[model samples]
Target chain A: MRLTTLQKFLWAAVAVALVAVGAVFLLVDRSPEPIAQAAFRPTFSLPDAGGRLRTPADFEGKHLLVFFGFTNCPDICPTTLAEVAQVMDDLGDQAGKVQPLFISIDPERDREMGLAEYTEAFHPSILGLAGDAAQTRAAADSFRIYYEREANLEALDVYAMSHSPGLYLISPEGDWLGQFTYGTPASEIVADLQARL
Target chain B: MKRIFATLALIAAAGPALACETVTVGPLEVSQAWSRASIGTARPGVVYLTIRNSGTADDALMSITTPAADMPMLHQTVMTDGVASMPHAMEVPVPAEGQVALEPGGYHAMLMELTQVLEEGETFPVTLTFRDAGKVTIPVTIQNIGASEPTCPSPDE
Candidate 1:
């Protein structure tokens, strides 16, 4: 059916309104605001391999891939560290711009030297850090990392720890960029790092 | 007779392709036996492998014994709510004509109180006892500390 001039004008106005709404939605979705930067830098002054206190500020110019795990952990900790090592390997020269930190939640057992041995096994550049009970708790709280000793702790050497497996990607400027869930591929991590860099 | 000979020849030609670094005992083929390098002598290490049963009957892995570890125990890593924990497992079941992969972040043997530090490129022997298949000795290769998956040379090569 042929439309009257008034009806045609009304349809054109509705089409223009739809296009304007679509453009506004797209603009809002693609806003230039940075994506979820941490309000403040989560700082920690944990002991390094040499029993010397070190802080995130020490690596001021490099991005930090921080993970919380105990050296005694047989499975998950090593798996994640392996993924980080692979990511660094895949990064090639860009690896120099990133530092992987493994913070031990089991400070009683994982000493500074032991932490050194553990982290060095994964990669020479990976740094192992540990702190006393209070320090460890504070660090975990700062990062919102959930960890607890197994309730039914067996004999001294046979106990297990239940810990969060998320890896925090902190920017060089000390802002939390994002968190990577467990089992994220190394290639994706490399891409994320490269994009951020 | 000629057709039967040709079939036999075909099977022989395909044999190497199916062969890997595996130990065959009874109907079970165990392959990719490996463990990660450890930092110290006392720290625990984990051993992983893939078990494939070809027979019509089910089998159960009873125990694992290795000199590298003072107390080798079968353990399975269970993840709940993004938290990982390990619990002792009595035995791992292998279904008939099915496979069970004892991999990282999954079922594995935890070597508690390691006698010696496991180093890369070193090999040790692990004897696995099965309920139906008796026992089989498999060489466990110590891989790099950051190795997450097993690497086997191509059988064709």
Candidate 2:
């Protein structure tokens, strides 16, 4: 015996739903993998913790992860470095091809040894760079970071400075790849970099 | 035996009970109200406050709410390649035992879109929304931006 019209309609609805779901998955498969925020590299000849000049030319053909911060930052600075350390680890052997750089915002306080000690705390692979205020400021401006000295004059060393919190990814050609925000998953970073590579 | 039992009961009744957090209006206890200042000439700003749980239960500070800005978010000021970025954060955990502190260079309730620049020693209403304690509206003191420590360092640098 033939089924009721209601029953036939239900079967047809099920067929349509299955096709729609399949087409969605097919479309999703065609899209590019989730790429990390593009990372930007700044030009600087500032000395590293060892007082050696590290310029853009040194990064000839390697992926670069750079962040601007000072030794005295208490929280976000440390946490973001820790996460970047994880990202380097996740890269495994390919990690050898990537360099993570820490630039000093407080160039006066973060001299050669100071920056070296700070970046080394996270990983031996991480390097700290520092330069005069004008140089650091240029790099910050290129990245669109907004930082200004706080208004109080009495506490010269205790003033507040606000800046962006992203680890920029730079290409071998030194073009800016997008950066990921703080606390990005290690797997996500590695996967994104791999696609870029 | 009756006298002994009565004495024992009295001792039990006299024992101190467990302490809970107490929420107070107006004045908030600040943690690490530092007298030290930054190395630059900019304003010396420190996030200060202590959380008191005056109840029998515990609560976590899920977020902070302030009308002073277009949006107030939890933020972590991180550094990379020498760049500092204060990224937005969703919540700051407040343990049952006490309140969490939002300190400088660590986690801070980032105030954005200020209706007016925060003036020193002025009080403004800031509401803290807790996971368990609901929302509490309190006045936050805008102290000297240039002061070095908790109270304020010397007027002279």
Candidate 3:
């Protein structure tokens, strides 16, 4: 017994509906899971340039733009700081809602070298943060930043530090939102922050 | 006499471009030499340039000397897995008939223990020693503290 045209059409429609449902399920299963907020949350208890202790709580309501470098880094650090300064400038009045921190990986020398003056040269809003060796290590670990002093046999006293060059973006609540790698233009950072803010 | 006068005029016209100058020594031509101004006297300065080799044999950059800093050494910023490390490079090779650029985030002359603070718009002489070319001094223009590229004087400026 041959089926009617309407019945055949109904069967075809049912098959298409089933396929569509399966496709949606497959796509949803294959999609990446959202990052765990707790795992990426970074914490630090370092001292600002004024020797006053600073923590994420201090900037409770402001977005944090964090960078790790030392005063002695000639190329990458300065270039990055300059970009940060540009970002701050572009932010204008909105910049007051953000706090930029330049965390020194080499606390011993950066302290003596005057981290405040170093950061101020870029932007007045930027606060240079430094701590003792152990504190520095803990802060770096929390940020997942890698740094090591390069030993030079020829000039033992003068050594350079090799570190992770990343500009991290932290939410006001202290969650690690994302990071802008080295070479990210200030315009891009400004746009990103504007959307978030 | 006309040809000599034209050559002199050309040199005079090219004077402004000297802000981004090229120096030739033996078979190597170094150009686009520049550095960023220092924040303070204590911070080290860095110099970046491009070296082109016209010779048939490869020549290595052996040493760098600059009055801007007491200890000028060749250093390369190496990045692996998003981690950055600047190691002292004993020599950077300029391949035969090839060019090597000492740009930012790459090979640079690390000026350790700056003798003087580098000021913007200033120029400093740095002597580069090559294995086959001996020595040649090039003027490195000082750009802004965070300048990513060599500052070229605009025609209007």
Candidate 4:
């Protein structure tokens, strides 16, 4: 195994050249964006409306489509879920690659059965989730969601909440990718998912 | 647009040319009254907008006026017993320095008992009545539903 000084220098030169070439490739990497590469995926292990713990890990290896809205939300929530179902239908075989999840910010009202019923109301694939105030707040904070209950001082029974309506796309690695708007056509979502897949 | 705003300011400052009191409300500034154009022989349509208070005083919106509708009340959409439902409302208020968003789903001016139809791309007039600001009219523009959910006016804005 003994080597001359010339042989040692030659080996050292070859190693250095390899390292230089690797660095150049790294610098010039213009590859497609990695799927859902969030530094820290804003995820939650919250309870379903039925009060059972639900975690984002349950939907790993698939795109987790998430939204923060209340069941009582008249305009946005229902319409958004409908659009999500439409997107799921559009995916066809690729649809299996993405799982739709509906997380309710109003855990107080979104009971487990209620959440299940709501999710089932749109499509069998959608999983409706809800949690107590703490868990709900944590989930929203993770996703940078803003929601508040609008209490009427005079009409206490008649109150509403304001919330964000963007659907998040989580990769199999749990990174948060950009989302589709509530009204984005289902065909567009399928196209984006297909490109990523 | 500049002329309209200028005329409104002059009327507000002068305090005499205006038929209604040129007063400030919560987050909503009152300029003039306006509503959507009702297509003749068509059914009534919904109208919505933001009511911002121009002063520090808190205010409550009392009513919305439209001649095209038989009744224009506050309406909200709710999920009850797993069913999607839209219900009527009596009032939506404007908090001090805060605003009343008349967006779809949560709080909206219901165009009930339509005397005429309101087609898309048509502008109309709506008189927003405030306890403090009196009656101010604003134009109602209709866009696709669910467009407001993602882009509600921000709090700092």
Model number with the top TM-score: 3
Give each prediction's root-mean-square deviation over alpha carbons: 18.5, 19.9, 18.5, 22.3
For model 2, the superposed segments whose C-alpha errors exceed 4 Å read A1-41, A153-156, B1-157
Q: Spell out the clash pairs found in candidate 3.
A: none
Candidates' chain A TM-scores: 0.78, 0.73, 0.79, 0.75
Error of 4 at B11 (Å): 52
Highest DockQ among the candidates is held by which one?
Answer: 1
Pitting candidate 2 against candidate 3, the one with the higher lDDT is 3
The digit string of per-residue lDDT tens for model 3 on A6-84 reads 2344344334434444554465458655534565888899998889999999999999999999888887888788888
Q: Over 4 Å off in model 1, which ranges?
A: A1-41, A152-156, B1-20, B153-157
Interface RMSD, candidates in the order listed: 19.1, 17.6, 19.8, 23.1
Instruction: Assess chain B of each prediction and give its TM-score.
Output: 0.83, 0.57, 0.85, 0.61
What TM-score do all the candidates reach, one by one? 0.79, 0.49, 0.80, 0.49
**lDDT score for candidate 3 against the true structure:** 0.79
> How well does model 1 score by local distance difference test?
0.77
On lDDT, the leading prediction is 3
Residue A153 in model 1: lDDT:
36
- What ordering of candidates by TM-score runs from best to worst? 3, 1, 2, 4
